[model samples]
Target: MNRMPVEPPRIPRRNTGVTPSPPFRDRLMALSTNLRPAAWTRSGIAGGATIALFGWLLACAGAAGGADEVRAGAQDYRLSGEFGLSVHQVGDSIVVRWMTDALVEGSLEVTTGAGDVVHRDATEAWTSHRSAFATPAEDSIQLHYGDADARHRTWIHLAERDPRPVRITGVDSLFVMADIHGEYDQMVGILQNAGLIDEELRWTGGERHLVALGDMMSRGAEVTPVLWFLYRLEREAEASGGRVHIVLGNHEIMVMLSDLRYVHYREMWLATSYGLGYDRMFDPRESILGRWLTEAPAMLQVDDILLAHGGVSSDQLAFTVESHRDTLAAYMAEDLFHRWGDTTAFFDIDSITFNRRVDFFWGDRSVFWYRGYSDSDTLTAELDSVLEHFDSRIHVMGHTPVPGIREVYDGRMILANPLPLGDEILLLVRSEEEGRWRGERFRAEGPPLPLEVGHPEG
Candidate 1:
């Protein structure tokens, strides 16, 4: 007797914005495997009922742009945490545009009054085509990113919008590591020595938070390992009730979008050995680290303390913490580098223009790329005012690499970048008993060495 095809489970409508949990992801994988044969029918895989149903469900859950033609100022539609779909009606045809930031290869299906129209690109860049429907049927447009492998599959719609403010308050101890520069050994060693993780690389810091202030991508041989190690640590830390906040840094932005001047020679060799381009190596749809990094925030708030790669300034004082949180909303990571090179400020531009073109992530002085903190004359007074406006007591950042960890402006701003040459980890412990934050430098062994560098004198 021929075995009947098992019915594929409908994608559930839960936690619509974040990454799918392991169990749900596993179920998705199982469904994909079970439905494979049926997916190869005459009208092609795109015509499969299972694929169509999956797409339709995603369209409904993510956005409500199916029947209603997209108009000006229509609500932004979200596909996942990093993918967004927008629709526009121009004359008779409806134009559809989707952005995932990472390189994606997938199928775009539009069910119109005429028939089912499908567009396929094996290597769709960060954005999808603006396919126009002259007489789109009443159904909707469904965009499926990632690939046939369930490992990178992502479903997006045209109506769902979820903007969550990222904020954390009240933590006893916070350990931050910045600018690893592809030094995986140093990263793992520092974590182990700090007792944040064990020799076996498991989270040992109970309830404490570890924030890696980005730049884990450049200047080293083990870029891949560094990316995945932190990925593993993130999950492990969460399991232990601790948290890992991997704030994006300038170097990370550099590597993700094909900028690789600082990438080590060995890494280039490794990519060539694998026959993968740097961009493909971290393609959000193809690489786990690429996808995970896409989800990382450019700046994060921890109680009264603000954490960013580059230091914040008075220019940013006008925006609220919530606004700062929204800066990363949908396109910051993917578009920042494309629109402007590293280190371009947006001060001369009007607020409205700046807000439309950029946010905390881009511009000469973007949170991820700014280097003014080290120069006291350029930022001291303004930094003080910005910190006060945000009600942020202290700011910890790491874009500016220093000979050693430095504290400027009476410890209001702390630079945590200890390049591989420095051979030290930046550690900040806020003891419940002490009720204050303090920074120290550490090796792979004993207690943190005293911070000899005093606060910069104005």
Candidate 2:
């Protein structure tokens, strides 16, 4: 039921469509924008036992955030269990990629949810096993990677909603979270508060969509565990007849392009230990998750609400949703994975904005990094047309964090950013008691926070 490809696709050197005046490394200081601030401080993962035993890489990843350096020391730390396991849908088959230190055969075993053994195949280390059943797995398929020496396993979610679709409708219940920034334990606690997952982190909220509006990785040292957890959660939720949507965030773009300024030093050390660069951790040629992530979806329409990491900007008002998708696909297809230009180091807007007028995926004006929504006048002026072009009643986005969850422009746009640990989250739920669908300001602990759009009466 499983096969391996000769090699994964390559991520070529990108051409940003702009000529550089000087070497990029030279421009790091003079043309750079302010380094993004680090995430809120968090200490100690409570349930550390379930986290997969992953390893570190060669170089120091980056300094820690919030003004403190990652104290994991300057030593190049390397250990075992750096398997970045992921299950990706590939053409009619499912490919399971598990990172191994060396080539070893007969290391894979797969089982059905009903306890039927489907595949016991020999797998090469550092490569994935592609599972192709005549009739695809309907719900879930449990995979056990590694043989007796060292092993890791999980059940892959396979309800199969198109990760990028034009629209999703008929969803009466959902949870909205933003900017996790690699705080795994805290993110789990937030999910637990809504009864979305059980104590074991298994999805229990049936048919209710949970959307993370982006920035799932970076900032914290536990990015590895967070990545694995979301991978598992997405599948488990899908199997439970629910869905988990990960809108692409600026951080996601940053990490993939070898920009590790905000990535934790521990994370850098972890990747170096595995004999790989921090960016290669998710590079399509190196990891299945990276292969999947490369084809990015800038926006997702869920029922009447549109989800994006950064809200639409004034410049994007003229483009249709399909036009945006086509553009994104074209860029990814051509393997145009360019890093941010020298002029505006941190996305599109440098303090100078010198030679930087980037409108592509990596630019500040692109969907992942735009902050124009923070300006009420500009946002309100263009909000209606943007929503109408996208065919959504509300546009929910994360990137520019507000003091609290915001329902701005008369609820036409919702901002869910800077969502700190135990902070408020926006919710859309079908309230049986009220006989209607409603939105609310929810938190992990304490009573529900008040929201003007609590009852949409839709």
Candidate 3:
């Protein structure tokens, strides 16, 4: 009997203003062996009808993951309590805060790197515990809760805000992946296969920078896990001399503005269960991951490549790297934080839209949302203009999902979005001899393949 080929079930994609991904453009691997990462093909694979139906059913069930964890968390907040905490080290004091159902005040035990524990009696400062520790922890910090009968611990630490570089001059090797969209397992698998991270999701890439072109949230069950992984991965990458650059995407902005349309049911249920609407769950002013979102750049240049969520537009060709970072959307973040700047500020989506019409950043042509690069009508000259303005050879962007990894204008533009994990990730390395970054694609448990694999147009 011949085996069957099956396309993955169609999950709804985030609103990109363009036609959404088709119901079954990409097929799936069997649930038994799990993510073998089916090699994408134009011709359908030969298989039995029964197997195809089985694959489709498996794909549909994949989206509802994390049910047990969500249920356990609903029963006891401690199970999911780490997400509610945010730690920031100020001038001489480290400020700690957490989201709680009711006013919470208790003893906050701090454990430093040297194995010393300092006990501080925390006082309620609104909805969560607020404490300013005189000791500065640039590395690991453990927060202890509960009494002798039962002990609970949540480890928290954030490296200094030295990330978000607009331009990086020298870098030999770089790993580029785009539009994670909460596919945490695939993200981990692909990165681990590339030798960028270990099985534990710790960065072992060593001086090798990792670039995420954005859309790290919404659409799947592992949204929180992905964010949290990247959060720690960023810090670990920095400590190992590698930097993790995260470019802002439309879905991330949508979450910040409480536009929760494309988010997975698991995350939505958690927010509702905790009474944290979308914004409060990942609020830019609170939630450690939410705070990191504001610091992420909309676009940046590394060596000869320009990385952006959506490729830059014609008018934006005149915008500088810093200007790209200071779009009105970014301004809205600071303004809203100062004006309302409280936990109660979320829940109101209307007040957070920030005049999307007038702001060029939120406009269709802006960096965070533009999709012109994917259209064949987009002139090569316009792309060349972008290259000349930024003095970069290639534009690496995500937003418009290419079937896999696509190279247009004979390799001047690459669109890698919403990593389906089918085609896996694209790796670009700086070639000192050629004096330009070269591109290649990598799939699950296999050697690197030619860039041509992703470009069927050839």
Q: What ranking of all candidate models by lDDT puts the best one first?
A: 3, 2, 1
Off by over 4 Å in 3: 1-110, 118-140, 144-155, 158-163, 328-330, 336-358, 418-423, 453-458
- Badly placed stretches (over 4 Å) of model 1 are 1-165, 332-362, 419-422, 431-434, 455-458
Summarize candidate 1's per-residue lDDT along 1-458 as a digit string, tens digits: 22112122221222212232234344554655665564443223232345434432332222222224221112232222122223344455544444333345533454333444454444444333334445333433444433333222222222222342357887767787888877767777778888888876778988889888878876555666666567667767778888988888876765653445455544443343334555555654435456566667777788778888887766677667567656554554443333232222122333454344434434556776666776554566778787788777888888666666777767788878754432677677776776787778887667888654643443
lDDT of 2 by residue, 1-458 (tens): 21111111111222312122123323443322233113211121211111101111111223322113433451322222323444455556665544443444426677887878777666544422333333255576777775457676776645533436546788898788888776766777767887788898788888989887778777665666676677777767878888887667877866665556556666665554445567767764435466556544777787778788887765676666657766665555432244321212222222222122224544566678766665444456677877887777778888765667767677677777633532666787666686444667766676657564321221
What lDDT score belongs to each candidate, Candidate 1 first? 0.57, 0.58, 0.62
Evaluate model 3: give its TM-score: 0.69
For model 3, what is the error of residue 418's alpha carbon versus the real structure, in angstroms, after optimal superposition? 5.9
Model 3 Cα displacement at 1 (Å)? 75
Lowest summed lDDT across 10 adjacent residues in model 2 is found at 49-58
Question: Best candidate, TM-score-wise?
Answer: 3
Which model, 1 or 3, shows the larger TM-score?
Answer: 3
Taking every candidate in turn, the Cα RMSD to the unseen true structure, in Å, is 20.7, 12.5, 13.4
Candidates sorted by TM-score, descending order? 3, 2, 1
